[model samples]
Target: MPSHRAASLLLALSPCLIAQTPASPAPLDGIWLGTLHTGGPSLRIQIHLHQDAAGKWTCSLDSLDQNGVGIPCTLSSATNPIAIDIPAVHAKWSGSLTANTLDGTFTQGADMPLTLERQSTMTKPTPPATPDAALPPADATTIRAILDKDLAAALSSGALAPSTNAGVTIGVLAHGKRTIFTYGTAKPDSVFEIGSISKTFTGLLLAQMVEQKSVQLNEPVRDLLPPGTVAKPASGSEITLLDLSDQHSGLPRMPDNFAPADTTNPYADYDSKLLYADIAHHGVSIAPGAPFGYSNLGVGLLGSALANRANLPYNDLLHQQITGPLNMTDTSVVLSPSMRSRLIQGHDAAHNSARPWDLDALAGAGGIRSTAADMLTYLEAQLHPNQLPATAASTPQGKTLPAAILASHTIHADVPPGMHIALNWFRADATGNFWHNGATGGYSSFALFNPDKDFAFIVLFNTTISDKSFADRLGQHIAQRLAGDPAVSLAN
Candidate 1:
């Protein structure tokens, strides 16, 4: 893999004028006052912003004290709100400007309960300034402390079912111009199950092949699949590769003939022979490019189609075309013993014991494993889609994949109030945030980045940590700290 200058978070746009920022911003320019509503109760949080003469914003947070003396806090992302994530603490936060309030949520870290709050104009009198020097400034340690709290909670919360005697592993990288703050196990070469993250890789590689003329997105799959290969769309003899990738093929989420020999490692038993045979027998139910339905089968079919045209095994094709070029050594469909050793044991429950489940049959769907380090590179490539080695932001193929990658980030469809699913990647909770996440039996993961803002983030947990309460509160905390301004947090 060639060296890629990893991508950064989306560049900050002046905080949006959802409602104009207070015209005569008070101490508000520096000190942020808000109440956190965790449902069980509310806690007061005070944040003091320090700006050098240059007008850049850096924040210091303190949960309100008994005497109201602002104690220093360790909220993550004070500099880049949209890129909020801290693995050591096992939490993420984000904020948005609402009609009148900065509505946000903060997910609990490893062991904490999540909080949700709306921080807006406060009438409370400002406390007399103590020597700002009394408090040590925020840095990686502070962020890690906050995240560590969450990590402990996540570990206890069944994120690690003993079925696998493994510790949960998490990786986080803060993309600042001066340095990248990375935190994880010292075993630098570990491989993690990035799971559905493979979908993003597949999307990008398909864009690459499209660039190389090795695969055409518009050509019907029938043109490539062996003759008589039966797909659901009997009426339309052709379903384009884009159809499969974009989830427009009208293909069922799981093929009718997809029963595998090993249910645990579902895809492991379905090799090319099985994939080809299945397509030939099982039929389609809808026309190509029809309604939107998420289909893992669609992803696998696309991968198989690409491999056939490229004449390389699917894993090797990924290496030669994407991971290898980006130097993602720890990312692959298959893991070596050395790399595997670093893997935190995957547990099936928050704090219970569980076994590892296999999905070899779903190779193209969610079979790839990776570490946070490798994902940072992938995250970077996404923000600067135009800066890629050979893919354009708008054009389908060529040097630099900006155009092609950008197409994947478009708001394809709405999933929730602040979420949408586009191609393989989806926008997470933040209004302007675009991201994707995945889960294996013992893992829960997240990757988010905004190209327009030049910012990015990735978070992976060993267990399912998607309970709305925890994630909501944690996300809120990170948002206030970062403030959705990438340049402030990451500006060199």
Candidate 2:
């Protein structure tokens, strides 16, 4: 998913070594704070500047959301319109200084406006609390009505439009029965890229490997890699398979060396060779099991390492472990002829036709394409694993699919604001709802389920829009409506 929240890349900064300071204060020597207004959640950025007696300037950056601090940066120019570059992350900033403010644009993978204001003291951000509304259970008919009405309204308002080929497929599982709804050109079998939701599947694969005793949660990741592959942090902290699954491996969201030949089809050329080279070049920065920092690179490496251990390609391993047993024929990284035929043409924010992404070696991070029907079947298994036949094929070490599903749901870490992380699935501690969302260049998808209430909601969009919260907000509202809570107005 190329979301500002998870997909946006940020590099961990090594501590900067400051030189001797001059007695006199330098004109631009202070902490400058700013915000990067991503279309989704905003990210706070901190730039620290200092000058030595020799008239030399040094700077460092901190991304508070990513927990990246003290990252040394090159001061390319130090004048009214100062130029600064963070080579390690391929980001640059050029701003005109006026008194205590530096207004400029931050260019990384994308260009975003940034305005830094000198602050007398550093500011600490507080995570928002999750809503704790008690939802009473509603019947299937009620949920269907609410969702149908909302969808119709959204379409009329152009929220779900280009109106020509635009499509949306939604599936809901309530009281052990499944119901699917489609709008515009969507059908039950319409295929769309599920983006970062692929991480949750990768997480399940790791859980199955652990259950089969082929891998240990605490095992060092290097053991699964090719000989001499560097997988240790400079801080002497060993990154474990669990660390990667839980988003605490201290790896960046994307590799610094990533220079895609075609930005539209970004990951197509990134092979294992490049992936391994990236790991060797930029080892983990933060200690394993520190703060939660989402890393596409970390999960992608995990998938690669797991495939290496199994002596199979990533897609092959995925079929052998997950999609195969679940009978999710439409869910796969490499689309079959049937799948390609059912594939929907994705649109960008401008409602213009857009190219689909080929994640290549990083496929585990955001690759799989699936249909709403297939996703609902997968979610149904999660809700009731025992329903799987006992004769179902097990892993090499004889671990059953049911056991692996249960293990994947076990909470391993806490994401603040009353939420828990279970493998790659996020759970609301208050509502006990497990959910994950994904997005690529042209598509967006969201899946959420509550086992206690015996309900699940899945929505797929064949287009990406500026309103990043639309799919998620709609899913949450549907969950609320299922709980018999007052229907929250859908975002137009």
Candidate 3:
């Protein structure tokens, strides 16, 4: 590369160059201080700014929590305003920079959009320099301490519950293996109920059967029901697994058959008889593949129908096919003696005793239990569908189950807002983040993994809510935080 003429000339004419240098540099190019407000989470930062002769410029931000750690990014349009993208965190900062104020929107993750303003003492940013990678040595320690302190603060302030608060655990997987950075429960082996997260299991099973030509995605669900099943509706025959997986089966979030006298543990009272009766009278509220209405009934009915195909009980098939092969020793519909001992106690907001739950009628929908360790392993399989252990151990000229699981976990239908539904997993656009969340009687759990980044995380707690809004908010918050959007402060 040729040296810049201006650079060479400047060295030859140092005195003249100094004679023309601007006495006062542009106000925008300096070491400036600011705050990143993510609504629920906020961070203080130091930003470095730089400009080129051609007007091209770059901006970097370093977080105080990260102890002035900086990351490089292109500054979009700086002529009349300013913009910044922290790719590492997927945070896009944009705003108008006037003589006195800087106003713009900062987007972190999926929880909610945040509007940020300059702190009262903010100053112009300094010339850009090579940004730091990790938090400062002492600040790294401080980050951990701050996390605990903030967590406590949130709890005391009612944003988080003491014992039953839902929290996230980050895990890393490498070379077909996994390691947990931090697990909530004292023991790394403890299991938490995986609630609707179990839907992926049913979906995987359905996809597996479909891959084998045993079941068709578009085939009517009616074909898979047990013989002598009841009926009282005209559109029941139109429902299909595809519809269920896509959340467009015209089914309600749950079934009317779920007459839970006790709202605390809703699914506990729903029986198999009621499930069968309801399906028999299934009158789809809308046309298949229409609007998306998240329905637990759709997945529940799908699981029941899948069990029917193999003439095996849902739990038996669940274990025999997926859990057994994966060696998920602790995941099961029924808790064993050893598992019961390892079970973490569920608690409410007051840290009071919470009831155990059984999703009998919809076991396939929300009746699985797993540890953070096992979930990492499961996520790994999804991330690396081709390199599954089953594939390596496959017998030549014989069938291998791994291929079926891969096909099952791939996107099957589109949901909304850059999301798509795979068999039992959720696809976060093309990011290759496949995930599912589970909530039992009193416990709520979230699991997500990105195939591209080799990153996976889980958030499990002993508190749950029947309120859909709360659950969605909690899930999105955990997801945003783990996906490197540090703007997500608390799990609350």
Candidate 4:
């Protein structure tokens, strides 16, 4: 006879015991798609399962909306109550399998209900390779020899993808002169994803819309959404567009349902549905307009809201408002066929090939890909606002660039002593310098400029290893030297 507590424990153990009864092997090898519903967003998830001749089970997870794929995983037990584990992202799924379907819950830090249905058709991905169009070695005279040595050492230090010839492209604009430097596999035209920097564009879009009076920065964000789409959080303070742009919207770094089916292409399948679902479910954790808290969701939501106001997609509004007028042909949410040919392969810190990211609903958070030349042209516009076409200061459409630029560069939040938030731009309160950094699974980018000194530099890399900081060092070194203050340590 068992005591009551012991009986309760046995009752709980009965499920696992029953589940362990090795029912027939469920023939789990196939493509399975599912949706994960959470308090924040609903993520679209996929899994690829296969069995080796040796009878070992292997699985790959994909978060369709997250632009992630082929996330390595292992399958436990071939029958009902199967468990799938992905250690790379510290995520797991446990559920009962019935016929060709799996009903389970996925957990990372939190839990979400998921249902997976098998599909007959799924294609394999191509192996990554360096672009054949890579240009011959170009002069790197503009790059400091010390910085170049550091770049070389960092790439060889086993911090980046092994055997992959990774490198960086440097572009500098200073004192009425421009210089371009290419190293490793990079060229002036090599394209790399410019991750979170896309937020700056979203901020600019906000400013433009505000100037047009189509949206108000300080107004409640619910005004832009379809009525009843988003449930305001208990926080009495309404989140404003300005709060979204300034990184203070109180949204989490990622939504609860941001579980990736494929970690490589993390944002591919996230749609507007997920965005709204997440917002309605979670609302803000802190007060809507609380202190600084960096959030991809905040900026992403801002982009969606702005797009709604303009009756356009985020990409289209970005083009009509900024990229088109700036003649930034190479900057876009999607690469053109020509750009694809020039796209450099990206690698992770472990020397493994990393799949490029694709943002569907979250494109505004970090979706644009660009080249060094194009970024330099962009920096030129930022460095010398007067050089832009007279109309560039004011979009013939409702956007007003002058006002937007001023608004973007104005300090909106106090960060650490040296830094502050200005719209989407990170400003150096001490020096009035503007800079931003972006990273994806396999790439990183840095841009810094001082309008008064007419100096700026852009560093783009094809690897997101710890060594990627070489770009920051190089950029800071160049900016400082160009400012005639080479003694300033980047570490400072």
In terms of lDDT, the best-performing candidate is 2
lDDT of each: 0.50, 0.73, 0.56, 0.67
For each candidate, what TM-score against the reference? 0.59, 0.77, 0.63, 0.67
What tens digits encode model 3's per-residue C-alpha lDDT throughout 1-492? 000000000000001101122232235655555454432334445556767686545565655443334444445446444555443232455655544344454533111222333344434333323322332222112333434543554455443544434443434453444555332433566667767788887887887677667788988777787666754244434777788776667665556566777755667778778887887776533453365455677888888888888888888887666776666777788888988997777654334556777777788878887777777767766776555555334432114456776677667676544567777676767456776666555566667766666555555555553211123333444444334343223432
Ranked candidates (TM-score, high to low): 2, 4, 3, 1
Candidate 2 residue lDDT tens string, 8-33: 23211122222232243236888889
Model 1, backbone clash pairs (residues 3+ apart or across chains), number: 93
Query: Deviation in angstroms for 322 in model 4?
Result: 0.4
Model 4 spans with C-alpha error above 4 angstroms: 1-162, 232-235, 284-289, 390-399, 465-468, 484-492
Give Cα distance to truth, residue 120, candidate 2, Å.
Answer: 9.2
Model 2: lowest-lDDT 10 consecutive positions: 1-10
Q: What is the C-alpha RMSD of each candidate to the true structure, in Å?
A: 15.8, 8.4, 16.9, 15.8
Task: For candidate 4, give the lDDT.
Answer: 0.67
